[model samples]
Target chain A: MPTIIEKIFQMHTEDKVEAGNTIWLNIDLRTARDFAGAKVVKNLLKHYSSEYIEDATKTFFTFDCNAPANTIEYANNQQICREFARKNGIKVYDVGRGIGSHVVIEEGLAYPGITAVGTDSHFNILGSVGAFGQGMGDIDIAFVFKTGKTWFEVPETVKVNFIGTPSAPWSAKDLALLCVKELRRKVLGRAIEFYGEIVDELSLAGRITLASMVTEMGGIIGFIPPNREVINFYSKRSGKEIKPVYADDATYEKEIDIDVSNLEPLIALPPSPSNVKRVRDVHDIKVDSVFIGSCTNGRVEDMQAVAKILKGKKIAENITLKVVPATREVWREMMNGEIMKELFNAGAIISHSACAGCASGQIGMTGEGEVQVSTSNRNFKGKQGAGDTYLASPETAAASALTGYITGVDEI
Target chain B: MKVKGRVWKIEKDGKLMDDIDTDMIYHNKYLHITEQEEMAKYAFSNLEGWQDFPEKARKGDIIFAGENFGCGSSRQHAVDCFIALGINAIVAKSFGAIYKRNAINSGLAVLECNALDMAEVETGDEIEIDFETGEIKKNGICILKAKPMNKIQYAIYLAGNLFRYAEGI
Candidate 1:
C-alpha cells in the first residue's frame, strides 16, 4: 500500500509507482514571482510563441518577493512581469498584493489532490491544504508552461506523528523548528507526512507554518492530509468539493513520534534554521529590530498573538518592530480587526503585504552591528541585509518586541 | 552528456565545507542581475573557491562539493551563474532539490555520487564524468560511480534543455 504521497503520484501518473521511480506527471497550477517569472517569461517567448501557453489562467504571476520595487533592477523585472502577464493573458498579483506562494492557496488555485509548481522553493506551503505542491526552478517552470508536464523521482515518505496538545508560547513555529532539528538532512530525497491528533487539531495558520518549513529539512513537501478541517476550509474558500486522501495503515518508510506538550517556545539562532534553542535559555541578547511576519508566520492568528502581547503597550524605545502581512486578504483582515490598530499603537512599523523585509530587507532593513529576531524562515547570514537574524515564533517575536532583547512570552 | 575536465574543490584550512548553500554560489547582491552573460563574473564571489574564477575558469571545469550543495533559496541564479561561467558539470554528495532540477532543465550536467570524497580530490585533479555510463574517474582511475539519470532526464539532457526537448517531442 502506498502512502498518501505515493498515492498522489500514482493517481497523477496512472501507474503503480514507489520510491526511486521516475515518472512524468501533468502539472495543475504553475506560479512565479517577479524575479523568476520575468526569466520564465523571457525563456518561454524565446522558445515558443505566446499561443504556446497551454492555459494562461492556469498560471499565476505575482510581484511579491521584492515588492514596492526596492531597486531599479527589481523594478525593471516587475515591469517585465507586468508586461508578460498582459501579453500572455495570465493573472498578475501586483506589488503589495500577496506572497505568491501563499496567495495561490487563499485564492483557491491550489487545493487537495492537485499538483502545483512554483518558481520559489516555499511552494510546499500549499501542502497545508493537502495539495502536492513542489517548487521548481524557473527554467523547469517555463518548460511546464510549454508542456504542462514534468518528471520527478518518487521519494520515500517520513511520517511524523504528534501525540500531545500544545500550550501557549509554543505554536507551529516551535514544532517546525524542532522538526528541522530532528529530521535535518535525513529527509533528503524524501517527503514528510504529518499525522496524529495534534496535527488535526492545529489551526490552519499552524498547519501552514509547519508545511512551509519542510524545505529547511530538505524534504520535498510537508503535508497534512485533508482532514475535515482542511476540506471544510478549502471547500468554503474555493467553492469546490474537496475530498480526503488517506495513506494505508503502516505504510511509511519511517515513523517518529513527538510529544507536543514537552515542547518549548523555540528559536533558531543565526546562520541556520536548524540551529534551534529554547527561547527561555537565551536571554538579554539585545535586539535592534523585530520583524514579525513572513510566509512562515504572517497569518491572522500570528497577528492576533502579536496583538495579545503588545496591546496597550509600546515597544522598546531601542527596538523597531516591523510587521508584514503575508497576503492582501490577511492585510485587510488585520486592518479591519484590532490587530493592526494594536500593532500601530505599539509603535510597530507595518509594511505592505508581501515578502518585503524577509528575503532582501526591502522595507525594514537591519543596520550595522544591529541584531534582529524575525519570524521569517531563514536566518542565514545577510539573508535580510546586514547584521544578524534569529528565527522565532510569532509569540516570541511579539514578546521580544516589548523588551529590547530576546525574551520569550514567559519572560514578558 | 559526457564531461571530461579538471576538478576544483572549495576548501578552508584544508577542510571541505558541507552544506554549501546557494547564497555562497551566487550572492544575493547579484540576484537582481538577470543577464545570464553577466552572472559568471560574480560566480563563487563569496565562496572560498576561486574569487577570480570568472577570469580564470575554463569552459569544461567541474565543481566537486560536499553534502547539500545549493541548499538555500530556489534561485535559478545559483545554477545559472555556473552555466554562465561555462562550468560543464557539478558532482556533489547531494543537491538541494531545486538546484538539481534547475541544472538538468538548463542542460547543465550534474550527478550524485555518495562516495565522493573531497579529501581524496584536490584542485586541478583531472576528472571525467560520463553521464551515459554513470562513471566518474579521477586522474584516469575510476574513483566513484554516480547515480545514473533516468530516461526522461537523459532525454532532456540530450536535447540540451527541457524547452528544446519539449519542442522536439
Candidate 2:
C-alpha cells in the first residue's frame, strides 16, 4: 500500500505515518539560498541568540540567490554560512559542489527518501529523486532549522502521467514549459508527480527540470518516483545507499500525461514561464541578449549543449550573449573542454561561477529595448534584464545569439 | 495582549506602496539583502515608509494588504519584519504560499475576503480576528469571514509550527 511518494518520505520518516492516504512529514533536512537564507539568518539571529536554537544540526545551506558575477557572492555567503555550519556542526558543502541547494542535496550525496525543504520555489526539484520537498517561507524554514521536522498540510497530488517517448532534442524541460503554459497561473499550490513510461527514461536532470518548472505553473515542485536511474545516480555519485521507492498503481489522486515523442523543442516568451510556444514558432524573433544560467539551466549539458551550437560560429555583433555555468564543477568541466572559449569566440560573455545573468541584472544586465533569448528557466517580466526574454533550450539560445533571433535546436 | 486597532495602511494593488530598488537593501552587487534585520524587514528594504512602521503593533491593528501579498522571492524576512513590527492580521486580496503558511503557522491572522474594504481599513482602525474560527471584525462590528486554515495547517498554527509542535520545544 506504499505509494511512490510515501516510500520516499518514509526513507527519512521510516514509519512516522502510514502511506495509504496523504501524510505530513518530519523533515530531516532543510536549506535556503543567499537571497532568502541571508535575510532569514539575519532575522533568526537578531533578537534570539543561536544558543536557543536546538536543532541547528539538521539544517544545511548553500550559496545561491544573488550569487555574484564571477560569483563573488558565493564566497561572501559561504563565509557566513560556513561559520554557522561549523558552529552547529552542520555539513557545509559550499567549497566545490556549491550551486543551488536543492540540486546539490540530490546530486551531492544527500540521501533519497529523506525529507528536504528549501526556501527556493523549485526546491521541489528534489522530487525527481522521491524526496518530499517544497518551497516554504523563511519563518517556516527557521522553524525547520529550530526543529528537524517540518509540518505540512497534505495537498491533493496531481499525477502527471507521461505516455510516449520524447523525440530528439525534445526533453522534459519542453514538457514542463508546455505544462506551465497549458496550466497557466491557475494551478498554484498543486504538486505534480510525473508517472508512466517516459518517467522510466527520464534522466535525473530531466526530472529535475520537470519538477523545477512547477514553480512556473504557480505550483510547488513536480516529482518522479525513484526508479533505476535515480538509484544508479546515487550509487555511483553519492556513495550512499539508495533504495528504490514506488507508488501503488492506484494511489495517485489524479493523472496527466504527455506524449514525449510528439513534443518538439519549446520556448517561453517574455512576461512569464507559461507564455510558451514551439521553438519553431519563434525561430525568427529577433534577439539582442541570450543568457544561459540559473539553477534551471545551469547543469553541465545545458551549458555544453549551448556550447556545441556556438562552435565555430561568431556571435552577432550587436547581440550580447551571457553564458554562466551553474556550478564550479560545471565551470571547471567546460573550461577543460574549451566550451568556454567557443562561447567567448561566439561573442558570449562568460561570467563567474554563479547563477549569473539570470536575474536582478547583476551580471547579465540587458537593456531597455533589447530582446533576450535565455536558456535559463523563467521569462518573467524583466527576469534577466529590464527587457524582453524568450526562453528556449541551450541549443536555441546559441542559435539566437548567433543569428540574433530565436531558433529551434535542430534548425540551427 | 489584544489591543484592537484599525488598519493603518494597506496596499491593494500588486504594486508596492514604496519603490523597491537594489540600492536600499543590498550592500553589494551580489543578489543578497544585507544581514541587517532592520534593513530587510520588508521586501522593499530601503523604502521611505519602512522607518515609519510602528513598534509593538497592537491587536486589532487593521493590516492592509495587496494582491498576492507574498509574491516575488520566497523570503520569510518579510513576514518576520511585519510580525516583529507588530502588525496584526492582514486583509489582502491574496497571499502566497510562504506568507499564508507562515502567518497561519505563527498564529497571525489574515483575511482574504472583501479586498477593497480590507484595503480600506486603515491604521488605527479597530479590527479583531478569532483564531479558533476564521472571523474578522472591523470597527467594532463583524465584517467578514476570514479564510479558515485547513485542519492540518491550523494544527501546526495552534502548536506554533513544527519546532514547537515537536516532542519538545
Top-TM-score structure, candidate number = 1
- Single out the weakest 10-residue window by summed lDDT for candidate 1 chain B: B9-18
lDDT (Cα, tens digit) per residue for candidate 2, span A1-412: 5455555655555345442233546776677666566545554675255533546555667655455424555456546666666767766545334456444654543456667777766676677777767777666676667655665544445677667766576766677787877664445555667777866777766676676677666555566777787788788887877765556664655566666677788888776666788887664577877788776777777777777888898988787777777667777888898788888887778766565655453465777878888766666554566678777777777777777777776765
lDDT of 2 by residue, B1-169 (tens): 2335566553325332321212222212334445324533443333344444444345345556544555434544455555555555665655655556766655565556534453334456666766556666666666666565556555655675444444343
The recovered share of true contacts, given per candidate in order, is 0.62, 0.41
On residues A236-307, what C-alpha lDDT tens digit does candidate 1 reach at each position? Answer: 888987776777783788987877777889999988899999888897799889998888999989999999
User: lDDT per model, in order?
Assistant: 0.83, 0.61
Candidate 1 clashes between residue pairs 3 or more apart in a chain or in different chains: none
Q: Measured by C-alpha RMSD in angstroms, how accurate is candidate 2?
A: 5.2
Q: Show model 1 residue runs off by greater than 4 Å.
A: A49-51, A166-168, B48-51
* lDDT (tens digit, per residue) of candidate 1 on B1-169: 6678878875666655677777777877777787899898888776654568778788889888778888878889888998988898888889888888888888888888777773366888888888987788866777788887778788888898888887777
